[model samples]
Target: MISLKKNEKWFWSGVVFIEMILFYSSSMTYKQQTSVPFLERYLRNKPLAGSLKHFGFNYGGKYQSIENDGYFHFVEFFVRKGAHFGTYLALGVLLCLALYTYFQKNNFLKILVPWLMATGLAAFDEFHQGLTGGRTPSVVDVILDSAGAFTGTLLVVVIVYFILRHKNMKKT
Candidate 1:
């Protein structure tokens, strides 16, 4: 596989900006339907319609049958309801961007700055939605969104550390 590119903060920022925006929006949609038969209800509703469930279908018709496999079912279920899936995807992209910037020493302020910004931004988005006619603000969604950033950041740290160690080993 090809190695990650260096100092691609601008690239990552744009991607994170877009992905997290969708993540934040999908999260709001997910939050709006969190209750008994949450996924089923939301999947039937507009904006987050049943069509979104297709994302988890990497193997076409076979994987489309979420009922047969536990993991695939959960994946489809989340695609059908939870915000965690979007959270993880956006955060993973953010982490890649973060690593590129960090290595280039261009990640100004502190490393946690992006993470905090993402969390705060999502919280703000939810707050903004609260101002709308039918939308409501949710603290739970913000927490989950922040946790996504942490999960991604932690993964990046561990993976990068191991990669560096392996490179040093190869030189010895």
Candidate 2:
């Protein structure tokens, strides 16, 4: 078991709480006119659809194809997935930092513990979404969330390693 100092405990707890609030808010369905109209208006004029089509990227589906009325939907889908990735990335960072602060002796534990916690939270978020009125759970989303967590954790490890190395060099 790892014991955190008072300030460290408060900071990590705040991060976890913010992540939970973000997940809860995202579980709600956004009405089309609320924000989609604004995004659609912007994307329709940006040539983004044409650019994607030029790259041979086909957003295939009955309602999500590039040749049909799916351009906005395609863009929106990526935007939503990007949000999932980014949010999980932040969660991963906080978890990794918390674990590192308490378990500084084990490199493996730092990575493994944060990864497991973030992945579990992702699964729980998906399940919660499924219970919402218009949201459906997806295994692919869980995978994406896990990948984001891994990337974030790896980034933190690299950053901390370099910082520690620099500090040691300065000490000599």
Candidate 3:
């Protein structure tokens, strides 16, 4: 039996909640998944479209035109990948934070454990997607997810380093 400090308990609870959310989202059907991108496209066409177009995003594929056809599938592809990256990025950050908080004395464990956990989750996520009817799980996606996780963890490390540097400077 392991007893957790109050903050540790809260962090672990949050991590579990995030995992549930990700799992639930992964369980959505193909058609159900499209709904979010559809809504995003609709909203982008509204006033926001102009701002995005100015930045050369053009969801309609007019700016850089990654795909010639104006079909929403082209936009949806990028949107989906972006979602994968963003979600895993968040997962990585949260996991790193939790591990860092719990293992303040072990600096190596703080980084290594979170990366391993995030990598494992990314692999599991792709495997779960493979079981879904409309989803085709790919190793490429796992790579992307792992990349996002690493990016997030690296960001945390950089931020923490800066903070510690600032704190040490203040003492001088």
Best-fitting candidate, measured by TM-score?
A: 2
Select the stronger candidate by TM-score from 2 and 3. 2
Show the colliding residue pairs in model 1. none
Q: Which sections of candidate 2 miss by over 4 Å?
A: 1-7, 30-35, 54-65
State in Å the error of residue 23, model 2: 3.5
Ranking by lDDT: 2, 3, 1
- Ten contiguous residues with the weakest lDDT in model 2: 55-64
| Model 3, runs deviating above 4 Å | 1-6, 36-70, 101-109
lDDT of 1 by residue, 1-172 (tens): 0245544655467656766565455446434643435544654543433554344453322454333543334444445334543564366446545555444453332236656766776677667767655565667667766777666655665666688789989999
Instruction: Give lDDT tens digits, candidate 3, residues 16-40.
Output: 8877887887787778778556655
Give the alpha-carbon lDDT of every model: 0.55, 0.73, 0.70
**Which prediction has the highest lDDT against the true structure?**
2
For candidate 2, report its TM-score.
0.82
